[model samples]
Target chain A: MATTRKSARTTPAAERPHPDATRRSQRSRQAIYAAALALVGEVGYPKTTIEGIAARAGVGKQTIYRWWSSKAEVLLEAFLDLGEQAVHAQGQEAPYAIPDTGDIAADLKAVLRATVDQLYDPRFEAPSRALAAEGLVNEQLGREFVAKLLEPSLQLHVDRLRAAQAAGQVRPEIDPRIALELFVSPLAQRWLQHTAPVSYAYTDTLVDYALHGLAPR
Target chain B: MATTRKSARTTPAAERPHPDATRRSQRSRQAIYAAALALVGEVGYPKTTIEGIAARAGVGKQTIYRWWSSKAEVLLEAFLDLGEQAVHAQGQEAPYAIPDTGDIAADLKAVLRATVDQLYDPRFEAPSRALAAEGLVNEQLGREFVAKLLEPSLQLHVDRLRAAQAAGQVRPEIDPRIALELFVSPLAQRWLQHTAPVSYAYTDTLVDYALHGLAPR
Candidate 1:
């Protein structure tokens, strides 16, 4: 449901004749997204309501209800927007996907290093953690977050790994879904659980250890 | 700090003369732990007060303060106690450590399989998930959880991997700490995030992938 939402506005939308009204609508949507993220981060999921988001965004309650059915939908779209903004801020093009550079190790390491930076970005950290914490207990919201947000990014890794397999980089027998977790989950656990520090060198080592067995080659 | 507190009392404490008083104290403590776990599981971390736990446990508020400093401390000890109970319920002896069966793959797989069982156990699942969710947002609580509960278990994996390294089963330069995550964190992420289903077969595959390179040998 969230995937189909056009989170990023294009020049074509701005190119519409009633430019003032379009700009006003865009401003209201951005304010609502920011307010939703901030409120969720501050008070957490259970306490955050559409009324709170509307008040925080300086819009009427009807404005939020007009756009989203629930606080979960609002937060989901807010997160998706945050991700796209983070990507654009990094000077990457819209619709970020894992690079398939032919050298699987180099490709994975580069993407993970980019991920390390994204994880550290203050804009992305607090609100994302807030939603994730809520998702741990709330089954419906958790599944929605996974389907709309996480699974899409993970599927990019699957695609990259499949490309690697075709190129004889990865073993054909490997399941890319499970295989991607070797490097991804460790960084995730560290970030989510505060288990350890993450760094470029650390992620680099993960790629190496994963591509080459821990057991002596 | 939490590690030093002996969670499981042995016969020596039970063997002391004043056996009726000792039995009563033990029963009260068990009731308190049960109350803490249940309350956290139901209401979540922020709202679970010591007074509330006492009310649920049918003990005075003073009884709780007499033993622990804060709700975090109580929950920590409660989790530690829960872990010990799970181990005992598995019919394993006290000081539950991973078995070092000389075969590194087999040893790791066995431990992970046991972990799969533990994750599925209803007694462990709800409270543990609740606490983990709290840890994601609560920095101090999260760090304490890592230092006391998580790191000790991870250290056991490190010890076993170091043994493997010594035996030339793992490469000499391999950092046992990071290597363990290639398998461990995946299971943890799946459980914590509900990112996917976890099963013995899934974990068994993780072990096989980690031990053998995803790349062609």
Candidate 2:
């Protein structure tokens, strides 16, 4: 989400500008992220501690403390990094923004299809679910993660919808914030609650139904 | 919810055939439900135990096991009872079906407004969040609760959509299951994730948007 926070925490020691130090620091950070995700996924958010994460990552506890304030921060950054990795793996660049392909429907459908794949990705599923589960009851963490992680992504939708409105695709009077929910929240609930199965077809239908209305066109 | 399971578990011993036994049994059952809800709310799902609920309710462990198979079943029944009680408090009868006033939008809005109130209700909020949180990490429990506690309520929406379709209020080709999510899921995700604040106005907007579509009509 916030590039500044990630960069500030993840960057190598400013005093040690050596290339080898930077490489080692990058390896350690990646290890920390991996350990944090795996620990949270296996033991859940409540039981996962910084000590456990450091132990699992083969890093000193001081090293983890030096970079991040809490396990929550670590997990949050890990998830953000995981998202970036997923996008890069799909051959997209970092800070991936929604495509403005001049066709709102096609662009929205493409993003949602990608999201469906991400939701099903084994790498993303367990840790995400664990964190989400904790967020439900842990109100402070819930609000923090929503503000930092989820809201930034949701804002992208608002931006796209506003663009659509300017282009005469979406109604000018519609609230982009609420309009995005019509398509996004259903898939989220399905994934979070295991309420139903999700797929390209399901998300495509959501896009069409959102654009065309459930009532007569 | 499944009425048969509730009735079978909640009923007094069939062999007793005495009014006193039935009254005592009903009192014990209510006490157990209240205890289960309070305990789960206080300590969350993982830490809550049958012995703990039994002690809190001042009932024997055998009484709990005799009636229900596990804590999940107990909590599910308690929530079902809580919903029934909420409806009753609203001066509505049990088995509270969605109203079909022939104006599909109005009917959906009315139910959603009631749901917003229910979500805000203190009695339902904490325990419900705790159960939902646990359900996220625990697959079998999640599936079981969704099937028993959630799907039945969702089915009400499906049924209402089907009626609207029959009456030509909704398009014939719309899948009631998917169509219902347009309005239902957004509210659900908001409540579940603390993604945003929910209110009657927000839900009313959802109903309007889902019915009318986001594009220019």
Q: Tell me the docking grade of candidate 2.
A: high
For model 1, the stretches where C-alpha displacement exceeds 4 angstroms are A1-17, B1-17
DockQ-derived CAPRI band for the predicted complex in model 1: high
Stretches of candidate 2 off by over 4 Å are A1-15, B1-15
Candidate 1 lDDT tens digits, A42-138? 8888889998999989999998887789999998999889889877877877476887768999999999998888887887788889999999999
Assess each prediction's global lDDT (C-alpha) against the native.
Answer: 0.90, 0.92
Which candidate ranks first by TM-score, i.e. highest? 2
Could you tell me the TM-score of candidate 2? 0.93
Q: Write the per-residue lDDT of candidate 1 for residues B40-69, one digit (tens) a residue.
A: 989888889999999999999998998899
- Against the true structure, whose lDDT is highest? 2
Q: Write the per-residue lDDT of candidate 2 for residues A83-183, one digit (tens) a residue.
A: 89887888876466899999999999999999889888888899999999999999999999999989999999999999999999999999999999999
